[model samples]
Target: MTSAPPLAPSFDAARALRQARETFDIEAAAVAGLKNRLTDAFSRSVQLMLEVRGRVVVMGMGKSGHIGRKIAATLASTGTPAMFVHPGEASHGDLGMIQVNDVVVAISNSGESGEITVLLPVLKRQGVPLIAITGGLQSTLARHATEVLDGGVDKEACPLNLAPTASTTAQLALGDALAVALLDARGFKAEDFARSHPGGALGRKLLTHVSDVMRSGEDVPRVAPDTAFGDMMREMSAKGGITAVVDAHQQVLGVFTDGDLRRLIENGIDLRTKCAKDVMHLRPRSIRPDALAVDAAELMEEHRITCVLVVESDGSLVGMVHIGDLMRAKVI
Candidate 1:
């Protein structure tokens, strides 16, 4: 018969909480310690990466490898071209990915990872610069490195003093510092980062133009200035909740919305005899089709209105954007 599963040990919430606090203290100190250790080598490393013609190839083993992957992604998204290659795979044939123009960032807490050490001579032969993130300054990886970054920590947060908790934190923090320095050196901006992250929220805000999300053609609700109030209300209800008042050349005269209708009724104005021009708000806020979708959202928010007209330079109405449209596009 199959044996039953073993029961879990008794819980210790207080001890668990104490251990967690100690872990935070140890890791925070590990990262903070790096600030004191920063020397000219750190700036040189950034300069080397900034001048690289090709990508930054990050390599590490196990946990360091995980941190290396994140570093590569951060660097790539921040304007530096980078990629992660597994060290073990490099031993076989993936080393071919490293070109002379590429800069290799190798992470090893002990600075003597056998897999990485074995590739040092080959990297040197290929003339690829090696930046080592290691706790071992006198170790083999550092000896072959073009630049040495101190990633040492006094101890691990692990109770046994064996796990890589503090060391990995230091490595990650150092990697982030390098990326930030290179980003500034390269003059990378938010818009440039957004181009690399087109599907993200910031990308949508910066890259999405007014023409992309506005309702155009028949979807836009528009009526001549002399249109009957009842007819304008029909157009508004059929479209969204707003109608644009336009002239013979389709230039925007004004706009009327559900908000205006309520205010007119509150003032006891008889709408049955009025036309679109009589009730429309003059000089309604408008945006151009070339502006960012986020700008449209900001316009609606600033005026406390639900919609705005997309117009040409000459004030001709082209499209309409509603708050709901911006919401659906997630520009806000």
Candidate 2:
């Protein structure tokens, strides 16, 4: 005799929306509850991570393993040396990856994942400091942990209360909290973050400097203060649509752009006698080559202009950056 087949799950739009809202509420409460549970253990955990000479080894099982991977990534990107080592794999030869100087962050909602529990004695023998993120205060993981972070949730968002929902959210929140505290303690800055994420958007904005994208050398349009209007126009048209007026020492005196020529023509001003110095706009907006490319974009946006000259501290013209250059670099 065969058992009856399970029925297909029925969908209810109104019930689905209600469940979504409840899930959010439960998850939010789970995170909020962590604030009151903060103890000196959090600081100790951060100090352990900060002082570790080797990488942070994060371990977990099942759903907790997924969260562990994310936590490891967050820690690594935030200036902490960290990587995830699956508990199941650790029971294999992968346990060799852990070093005595490394710190271990173990995650388990029940605090009794067998794979993680089995490795406790070995970790203890190796003298690796363990920080446990778990809900069971008196479970095996908590017992062996040098620091135990309470990730307890009153109830799961799942209707059956069997799935890891609110519990996992609480674990993730705790992981973020750890990373944030560790980063703060280490004095991690945006520049450090950009260095770790050189391929990301923030990296592009922070690591890319004006020198990286600015037109330099012969590509930069420039003219002497006494250069003839026709000669300056020729240089500007050949280089870019703008020309910088400089002294004998290459110290920027002013700038003349295509817009200036258009305005001069519109006003019917005599241009035949107008040398670079005669028609140039004095003290045009400029940026240092070491400045972030985003700053150059901001300067262009603020001045309602499409080009910005790059200069040294002493105001010597080094290069020029156009909005087009910034666009090509994706700095804008």
* TM-score per model over all chains: 0.96, 0.93
lDDT of 1 by residue, 206-261 (tens): 89999999999999999999999999999999999899999999999999989899
| Regions more than 4 Å wrong, model 1 | 1-9
Every model's Cα RMSD, please?
1.6, 2.5
10 residues in a row with least lDDT, candidate 1: 299-308
Candidate 1 — which pairs collide? none
Error of 1 at 177 (Å): 0.3
Error of 1 at 264 (Å): 2.0
Per-candidate Cα lDDT values, in order, are 0.95, 0.95
> The CA-based lDDT of model 1 is what?
0.95
Backbone steric clashes in candidate 2, count: 0
